[model samples]
Target: AQSVAQPEDQVNVAEGNPLTVKCTYSVSGNPYLFWYVQYPNRGLQFLLKYITGDNLVKGSYGFEAEFNKSQTSFHLKKPSALVSDSALYFCAVRDFWSGGYNKLIFGAGTRLAVHP
Candidate 1:
């Protein structure tokens, strides 16, 4: 049972707008999407991963993510938005019951307000 859903708790874009932080997932066999970004006290910063050949997955600062296996979704994009790209955004999968290590099943944090 792998699940992730960031149905927006907050997302406001202004500074050169073009930002989306919405993720939806529910794994059973193959699904490994990830995107993390947190800055306030700074900790979880890894902004991009789709784990199996392209569906448009780029990483780091000017983030990119689009792995839509028929809309099971993995959407995190930033064409412009900055204000230091305000923080707190996460969407994860891959928690194969902790045996494969690197366990992750998160998605309840999306607060990115890049205004001016």
Candidate 2:
């Protein structure tokens, strides 16, 4: 089984300051990690993914995440945050050995609050 943990229930950051949201995972074998964001009353939208490649991966909206295999962590970072960046963020893990079916297990989620 694969699972993700976002220890923080919420992250508070001031506008124009850099922000980071932490995520960790546990799974057997290689893990496919993903990040998604959700706005008010809107469905979750894909933000970034770590399938294979460089340890550092960049995604939409000036967000980036570093994959640490040893730590089993993929923490989301933004150079500078905006008030509009306030949203719900989720970390998900996918296990390929799950009987050939695509199953994504999501974290409890971390709410980002960007105060102006």
Best model number under lDDT: 2
Clashes of each: 0, 0
- Model 1 alpha-carbon drift over 4 Å, by segment: 1-14, 17-31, 34-51, 58-63, 66-77, 82-88, 98-104, 107-110
* Model 2 Cα lDDT, one tens digit per residue, 1-116: 56899999999999999999999999988888999999999999999999899989999999999999999999999999999999999999887677866588899999999999
| Clashing pairs in model 2, backbone N/Cα/C closer than 3 A | none
Per-residue alpha-carbon lDDT of candidate 1 for residues 1-116, written as tens digits (9 for 90 to 100): 67899999999989998998999998876787888888898799887789899899888877898998988999999899989888899898988666776689999889998889
lDDT of 1 at 73: 93
Q: In model 1, state the lDDT of residue 10.
A: 95
Candidate-wise lDDT, in order: 0.87, 0.94
Lowest lDDT 10-residue stretch of candidate 2: 94-103
Off by over 4 Å in 2: none
Ten contiguous residues with the weakest lDDT in model 1: 94-103
